[model samples]
Target: MKLSAFADVCLRTLMLLGSRPDQLITTREIAEQIGVPYNHVAKAVLELRNRQAIEVTRGRYGGSQISARGLQLAVGTLMRDLDVRDDVVDCVSETGVACPLIAQCTLRGALRRAREAFYAELDLLRIEDLTGPASRRLLPFPVLR
Candidate 1:
């Protein structure tokens, strides 16, 4: 399943924040790092915030930060949300109808199995796993400003 660019950005931003859990990253900073429009990043950040995947702080130094809850949600979960349902059906419905050989086709059965397997694999992965040790070592230092 293909993930939307916004979703990719969201995951990347979350991972970046996860790497530096002590720092609050602003939307402009995320946009600069990802080479995307700040508005786009803002939208994705908002969506993530709405989902409780990230926390948003409002102030002169307000910024976004990934919450423990967000870190628990895996990349797969985000991808799943971004995936287009039409694409899933497109793989099985070529002409808006079930395969003609539905009664005897093993291919369809196999496709179903493949889809299940895909989701199963995703289920095993968590957001924390994507952050890796490199990010952990880069945690930001506390600042008084």
Candidate 2:
């Protein structure tokens, strides 16, 4: 399954922070490097801070950095937290339309299993995995991985 743009941004933000464990980086810097809007980065930063996945320092020299826990955070858990929508299936849509096969659909179960398997695979990864040589090469700043 393809990840939403917001989720991709969140993961990119984590990777940026993870690549530079010793220094704090600003949202604008992240946006510039990742080629996303500053406002999008800001929103992602705030969400990460709220989830305790990253720490933010507010001041003239304010910036954000990944937390220790965030570095070790399982990709599966992060995905679950960031992709908090229950409408993976058409039957689960918030819209009031009722599907005739809702009571007998095997597709729902299959989809659920597929999603679980996806998460299970993601669980094996950590933020460090994303900040490897390839990521460093792609990012604008010098990432010491």
TM-scores for candidates 1 onward, in order = 0.72, 0.87
lDDT of each: 0.73, 0.84
For lDDT, the strongest prediction is: 2
Cα lDDT for residue 107, candidate 1? 65
TM-score of 2: 0.87
CA lDDT, candidate 1, residue 92: 50
**True-vs-predicted CA distance for residue 75, candidate 2, Å:** 0.7
User: Where is model 1 more than 4 Å wrong at Cα?
Assistant: 89-113, 135-145
TM-score for candidate 1, please give it: 0.72
lDDT of 2 by residue, 1-145 (tens): 7677788888889999988887889988998887788888899999899988899999889899999888989998889777776656667447787887788888878887888789889999998888777878777643311
For candidate 1, the lDDT comes to 0.73
Candidate 2 wrongly placed segments (more than 4 Å): 92-95, 140-145
lDDT, candidate 1, 54-98, per-residue tens: 899998999999899988986666777766553344435656776
Give me the candidate number with maximum TM-score.
Answer: 2
